[model samples]
Target: MKTLLSTNLIYSIMAKEAFVKEAADDILRLTEWIREVFEDGGKLLIFGNGGSAADAQHLAAEFVNRFLINRRPLPALALTTDTSILTSIANDFSYDLVFVKQIQALGKPEDLALGISTSGNSVNVVKAMETARAIGMKTVAFTGGTTRPGGDLAAVCDLVLNVPSDSTPHIQETHLWLEHVICEIVEKQMFGTT
Candidate 1:
């Protein structure tokens, strides 16, 4: 049991360390994208499945409410927050249309869509990214595994951040760290504070 715990801890630690090393440039680009959108009064539309969905809502709340510092609320919406819309879209159209339809209706050219998928291939997220692109909205994705430079989710997203690990927990953990980093940078840039 100790060996298993130690192995898991080491795996997570090494995965995060490698991600931090490899992701500096990509992180900069993503922060810039968020900065541009917020500067332009564009909202962020975020979504994902399961834990990623929860992460989407968490990130949105950070933008809409507060992150580390106190400031005016930023505009951010998580498509996964509305169960009625999700169920309606799934029932009336299809499960894949949940986020796509929302993006089609709520998205604008200046807005941004962010999708989080551990496998980098969630169909609904891929569809949402595609729709957001066709609408001229910028798309960004947080996905798992470093092996896929750009997976199916990459075809539409303007930026893709893939955590360099196969373990879902490790991927999600790294994603949480990135989300905090992104919110902090965006808040600081938008509000002009530390």
Candidate 2:
């Protein structure tokens, strides 16, 4: 049991280290983009499917509700959070159109569209990014390693942050951490240390 615990801890540390080492530059780019968006009063629009959907909502909440600072709520929306819109779009158009439809409705040239997908190829996320780009919104994608479908979506976005791990668990863990760090940076930049 002791040996097993130690091995798991070592693996976790190694996984985190690999992610940080490979993705440090990408993380900084994301932080810079978020700061730019906030400075320009541009909103953030985020979406995904399943676990990625939850992650999208989590990230939006951090920006809209405050991450580590108490200040005015930032402009951020999780398209995945609205059951009515989701169902209506899924019913009228298609599941793949759900996010795209929302983007068409709410996105503007000054806004930012953030899509999260472990595989990077989620059709809905890709569609939304396409729509965002068509309308001149900046696109950001958080994806797993190079092999996943989500990586394709990352190709379309203005900036892509692909965590180094191919394993879903490790990828998702890194995604959560990256999201938290982004929120903290955005918050601090927006509101200062006070």
- Mark the regions of model 1 whose C-alpha exceeds 4 Å error after superposition: 192-194
Across 149-171, the per-residue lDDT of candidate 1 in tens digits comes to 54689787888888878889999
User: How accurate locally is residue 124 in candidate 1, as Cα lDDT from 0 to 100?
Assistant: 95
Question: What TM-score does each of the candidates earn?
Answer: 0.95, 0.92
Top candidate, metric lDDT: 1
Residue 129 lDDT in model 2? 96
Alpha carbon lDDT of residue 119, candidate 1? 88
Clashes of each: 0, 5
RMSD of each candidate relative to the true structure? 1.4, 1.8
Q: Candidate 2 — which pairs collide?
A: 119-150, 120-149, 120-150, 121-149, 121-150
